[model samples]
Structure formats: C-alpha cells, structure tokens
Target: MVRWWRRPWIVPFAAIVVIFLAFSIPPYLSFDPARSRVPQPPSLGVAHFWLLVPHVLFGSVALGTAVLQIWPRFRRRHPAAHRRIGRVYVFGGVLPAGLCALTIGAYTPYGPSTRASDVVLALLWLGVTAAGWRAARHCRFGEHRRWMIRSFALTASIITNRIWAAVFVIALSPQLDTTFHGDEGLLSWVASSAAAWLGWTLPLLAAQWWLERDHLRTRRVHSRPSASPTPEPALPHP
Candidate 1:
C-alpha cells in the first residue's frame, strides 16, 4: 500500500489551494473603499484596508510557499530551497496574515461566534508556526515536521472556512423568509458564524488524527520484541 504521505492527492490538494487563493484575493487588490471585505472599525477608518492588503498578500505568499514546504519531493530534492521558502512562509505569509486576522476577526460583522473562532484560529496559526521554527532551530527535525503539518493545517483552514460558509448559506436559504423572517442580513451572520466554527476546528482535529496515526504506527513497530539470535551449527570440518 502507498504511504499516506506519498499519496497522489497531496499535489492536487495544493493546486486547489493556490487556485482558490487566486480567485479570492483579487478583489482586495482593487483598493477601492467600496470593495473592502473587512469592516473597518469606526476609529481605524482606512487603516483596516492597509492591514487587509498585507494580510491578503502575505497570506497568499504563505499559502503558496506552504505548498512547496509540504511537498515531500521538494524537501528531499532541495533542502536549501525548502529552508528558504520556509522562511518566506513564516516571515512573509503567516506572520502578517495571522496578525491581521487577530484584529479583523474581532471586527467581523457576522457575529460573536465567528469573531471567537477567527481569533482563536489566528492565535493557533502563529503559535504552531513558532513551535515549528523553534523545533527546527533546536535540530529536532521530527518534532519540527509534525508542528509544521499542524501549522499548514491551520493555514489551509481559511479555504475550508470559505467552503463551509457557502454551504451553510445555501443550505439555509430555504428558511430565509420562514425562519430568518426574510432578513437576509440576519441569515448571513448566522451562517457565517456557524461556518467559522466548523471550518478550522474540524480540519485541525483531522490533522491531529493524522499525526497520531503516524505516531502510533511508529510505536507499534518499536514495541515488537526483537528476534532472538540462533546459535550457529558446529562446523562440519571439526
């Protein structure tokens, strides 16, 4: 059986992430006040837009680099390149985007649930990446790899969040008038917040399950008793 890490789906998964990032990020680049996705705080005014730009741009950088970072073939063939891209993913992509997410999440018009989820997600992303970097610096490569798998899981959760949000909205549409009282705005926040909770949390749980599966397999191998050495037969020449 093929190893899970070497499965054919990994590359295709990364490509889909890149494609989604491309489709989602362009509207922010227009820089028109009318097009801002983030709700600017009354005091912050246009400052939110400034933050959103780098957040999206660096996020794209991080998302793109993370694809390379996670590619087993890339790491095996170009260790130095992998290290360089890791730096970019950390310093450029996740660092800025995670920071901006802290503020943006709090300001989300959706509801408290979404705000809560986003803040928590941002914190975990940064914390996981930091742990991964520390592990690498200390030469604990195994631990580093595990932590980075987690960080990428968090990084990719945004894509999942978008998908969940759309799914919830569509699924709830039938109740727009009967249940939501025909308040489109009300339904929007309800779905958005619900999606926010499921998106990152579910993916992170799956990542943990994946990591534990590998760890358990390793332990199982090590726990097996070694075969006893057999005595050699007396030489016929004797």
Candidate 2:
C-alpha cells in the first residue's frame, strides 16, 4: 500500500523527463551514420553504429514504457493496460537493448574501464529486468513493483550517464595540461570511463537506498507483536 508514485514533484518530474528524453533520443532518431555516438570509418565501420542504434531505440522503448508504468493512476485504473505495457517493456525493449549493450560493451573501442562498467551495467540491467518479470509472473505484486522500480532506475540512468560524462569532460578537460600532460585524448577517455561507472552506479544505489528504507520501516512495523487476550489460568488447584 506504499504509494511511492504519489509524490508532490510529479508534474515537474514529468516535465524534466520529457526534456531529458528529448535530449537523449533525437540524435539517434534520424539514423544518420554520422550522428552515431560510436566512432565510425575504416577504423570501426558501420556495424557498431548499427548496434548502437538498436540499443538506443530499444532502450527508448523501455524508457517510454517505464514512464507509463510508473503512472499510478493509469496503473491502478487499468490493470490490463499496465500489464500490456509491461510486456512490451520486457520483450520489445529490455531484451533487445540489453543484448546490443552486451555486445557493444564487450568490444567497445573505449578503454578497459569503460568496457568493464558498461558490460556489468548491461548484465545487471538484463538480470534485474528478468527478475521483475518473473515476480510479476508469480503474482508477487509487492516484489514485482520493487523490482520493476529498480529496473526503471537503471533504464533512466542513461540520462545520468550523459550528464556525468559532460560534467567529467568539463571538469577534467581543464586539467589536461596539468594532469594529463596536455593529452586531450587521454583526458576525454578518463572522463568517459569514470562517468560510465559513476552514472549508473550512483543512481542505482540511490534507488536501492530509497526502496530499502521504505521496506525496512514497513517490516519493522509489521514485526511488532499485536496484543493478545489474556490466557485462562490453568486449573492447577483442581
């Protein structure tokens, strides 16, 4: 009965989410080879670009579905519609996106640090989503909600990933001459790698913290014993 979605920030939060997705998804929608974030050319070719495209597109599906899924009124009023959206989120979104991410992460042109972080993120995303789906399948609504919220946190971390990347690039770029021996490339790589780890990890940790505190508080309240009728004294004298 904990209604985490009934928050005062819902309107502003939705507005921010709309803007975030606008920034996140437009470049990839054109499908122009040049617009791809992954480097192209004789160096890497169009194959990785293709992979990046599907990953972004499918992830967009997941993100869109997550926005709908978290809408408490819609979910409460239309259970069937909510279930259908959840299905698309799992099948059309997470599965394809996660596979592409796993592939791209495995053979990224980036350094070991970025590769490791991305690979682990993909695996955890896939695993956590699957767990949520399983919980729903078993009709464990409470567990399902928690698991799905965790999944959404990971999905939405794509925004944080870009935000952190920009932050690191700005902060570290200035240090190129002093710390990186004027190596702009090294500074960029370091920034990217660090962002890859902190972006998802920090957000996911925050989500877990929020969920854990609620769960702990509820559990403690439930664990307290209820008052009972006084027991009849045994007829020891008889």
Give each model's whole-structure lDDT.
Answer: 0.87, 0.86
Considering summed lDDT, which 10 consecutive residues are worst modelled in model 2?
1-10
Q: Which has the greatest TM-score?
A: 1
TM-scores, in order shown? 0.91, 0.87
| Highest lDDT against the true fold, candidate | 1
User: What are the runs in model 2 whose C-alpha is more than 4 Å off?
Assistant: 1-6, 41-43, 225-238
For 33-62, candidate 1 gives per-residue lDDT tens digits of 668765666656787778777788888898
- Model 2 global lDDT (CA atoms, 0 to 1): 0.86
**Candidate 1, after superposition: displacement of residue 211 in Å?**
0.5
User: What is candidate 1's local distance difference test score?
Assistant: 0.87
Q: Give the TM-score of candidate 2.
A: 0.87
